[model samples]
Target chain A: MGISGAAFIAGAYEHPLRVIPDKSVAQVHAEVAAGALADAGLSFSDVDGYFCAGDAPGMGGIGMADYMGLKLKHTDSTETGGSSYLVHVGHAMEAIHAGKIKVALVTLAGLPRQASANLQMGVTDTPEGGFENVFGPTIHGMYALAAKRHMHEYGTTSEQLAWIRVAASTHAQYNPNAMFQNVVTVEDVINSPMVSDPLHRLDCCVISDGGGAVVIVSPDVAKGLERHSIKVLGHGEAPKHSDNGKIDLTYTGAAWSGPAAFDEAKLTPKDIQYASIYDSFTITVLEQIEDLGFCEKGKGGEFVADGGLISPTGRLPFNTDGGGLTNNHPVNRGGMTKILEAVRQLRGEAHPAVQVPNCELALAHGTGGSIGTRMGSATLVLGRD
Target chain B: MTEATAPVMPAPAPIVNPENKPFWDATVEGRLVLPKCQNCGSINWYPRVFCPECGKFGVDWIDAAGTGTIYTFAITRRGMGAYGKAGPYVLAYVELDEGPRIMTNIVDCDVDSINIGDKVRVVFHDTGSGSALPRFTPVS
Candidate 1:
């Protein structure tokens, strides 16, 4: 009755450019779409379902469907910030499970680095804008609030948080397209200038102008494909908001989403061979690791320390493609890259230096919106056939 | 030597809406009011018209105790847009005595001295455009 084995991710393509100054956002989206379709040994005309998020140019899914000339029978324009693509992947699986479409195409693209000023200044008028807008909470400021609260409540230190950036850098060394390639030490992270209290500049992800696309197909459609397909084992999504005034900064929506996903997959955290966690900030990785049941609630600091997240030797080798922390957070949306890496690992297509020996099961988790405020979280479990 | 008094960034005028108009209106008179559900009696922040708990209308704006304690805070060293020039400001949420926590800036104190559970009281800052924004200052 579940989506397990109902759909397969046939192809994934991450646009190589970290900064695309010459190309438009829609152009990047189209390029990645073509690349993924070609990799899957399918044509653009084969795609019957289109999935995108706020990053897509024009009117999201509908607009992109037209731009890509995709004759889609189904489309989803679910906007969940950076986690939109992960959520879209889950939604695509449900559609395939229900026999709505055969070949589903999911894409994300943005130029946040080029439009940094406008993106930061742009504020939508929501019901809560009146109360929050007047406080001038920047993106860094919002995440810093959560980081400070976690440190206060759990005794998480800046040195421990620095290790996340270190782990990411360690893997980024092998990624030719990574925005940061040099391995950084704990001292480098600790000594970096603080953008917000407790969160150093290195703790933040690089803003890039790139895009990625994934081709998901029904199990029936996969029989005709030549590329190795990764099975959709389980998916879960949830939201965590400030409960009136009672807000707990110690945990994330992953606490709910991760377990729901594992339950459906009939697996535990121990079974996950790889994880592609959203890394918008160091505190994000630390908190999600705890919430994902990788370790005890307050023991993420110890779990992530001493080269624990480094590839080959770590208990769970994560973000082998360097992840958003060191590679690219295209258009500031990281959900797309999370899935791309997990697919790479499951297909044994990752760089040999950082790839898990036999990555059987992988988990990719994404948190959309600000961690200090309300957010949509999505978790996906994928496996090799 | 704390530069906590560094420049107070004038907040961009809030987009006042019907759901939160009364809450902003009360701040002009230097009074803090919270929406209390007439059905469940549970209070909520952001002054919503309907009760988030009981799902009923006819909520009342009750006067709130202006005093609270710092639940959490971060000293933002860098800011964007209008806050770009305002250096080293303490952005925080204070758990009000009335039980609802509110997001506000903690002014008139050393940034390094502010900690979770520190007592604070609300102070109204006139926005020069008919409404006032409620900020907090250390109780001590």
Candidate 2:
């Protein structure tokens, strides 16, 4: 019972708005769900399984299901921060394979920009919170720690990490819906305000308010759809934590999840023509590109240097939708958008300027939570067969 | 080396729980203690009841030398939430002599001069609660 060919991502939709001040989070969820189902040539009535993450309002999947009028036989509200949607895709594939349901709808939405004033460090009365919250570890600070360590150990320079943002911005030029459509240079990133050591403001993803959805279906239901569906080739997820004070900031959970995904897909990193590497920050992409076996562990700097990740001319084209970097990081969760871009690439519907030619096999990887502390990482392999 | 006075930081009182009360109790007395698994003889940080290594329920508190080298650090120019105004601080992990690293702040020194492998010793910042948060300063 593998995910390979077990399910198809028949529908994918991304909200055109990067800022949705007027709409409620629940409304965005419903809108994306409808867009995805409509893309699949189906309607909300066809969805029998609903999947969501912490981004969902109220009781998670239960609340969204009721709001959307989704009569479901099965539902999942697994929350993994940013990577929740990728996890949902995997869970949906398993459910479909088990014959639990024929069609599953996964939705994600957030308005962090609108909620920015109220954003807190998220310290609370949890098990690890008492110990960690006192020190004041912001999201930027967490990734900055990893970046600093990676540089100290591997001689990774801030310039090398800058290439990732450059690549994202380069592709973003053609994405009309992207928040930042202007192409930037390495010098630009290096000169940007330092929010945290080794991480400039441009190195981080844009905060926006929007949502996206993907409709996954069993092979039987997929064959009846009017649009071509991307095959679910493989899936993997893993959690990386501080190992009881023996924390290693040099790597991420991608080291475990990426291999598990590639092995299940019976493919190698070299086989992937396009990738949707989550871009919470520039260092985020560099580390995942290394851990995903695209390059050696400490060789990420060289791997991404000199247009390595730029589309068409680059070695590995990634985040053609501008990713969370230049595009939008809705709700501060990027997993859903990662899957949407991969689906677009496999279907050859990505922006022509950044779309990989003859693109057949693509991989999308997402990291939820902080890479500096604990994180939930998920990887997926999708193909057009 | 000790700071002439306690460095000013937004040291919030840790939410005390049953599992970590002993560790905080030691801090209030101006000491750093770690949980040592009696079954495996492995020392763990954060004072967990069970050993993460051997999965043993029995453990003992061991006083630490409270001196370690910096593992990694980042200077946050803009902090988070309540820490939003507390910028230009060094957030670091200090690898203690007890074979475990603890997340802490490296204070009372130039933030720009802090680096990995710099030796540091522990100092306490009273959180207005009974317990004090253990931080580190560069070994001059």
Candidate closest to the true structure, highest DockQ: 1
lDDT of 1 by residue, A267-329 (tens): 899999999999999999999999999999999999998888989788678888888889999
**Chain A TM-score from candidate 2:** 0.98
Error of 2 at B121 (Å): 0.4
Model 2 quality (TM-score)? 0.97
How does chain A of every candidate compare to the true chain A by TM-score?
0.98, 0.98
* Model 2 agreement with the true structure over B1-140: per-residue lDDT tens digits: 22221246788898888888999999989999988999999998767889889987988988999899999898888777657677577888889988888888888987767789999999998888878989999999
Per-candidate RMSD, Å: 1.2, 2.2
Model 1 residue runs over 4 Å out of place are A118-121
Give the lowest summed-lDDT range of ten residues in model 2 chain A: A115-124
Q: In angstroms, give how far residue B61 of model 2 lies from its true place.
A: 1.1
Q: How accurate is chain B of model 2, given as a TM-score from 0 to 1? A: 0.92
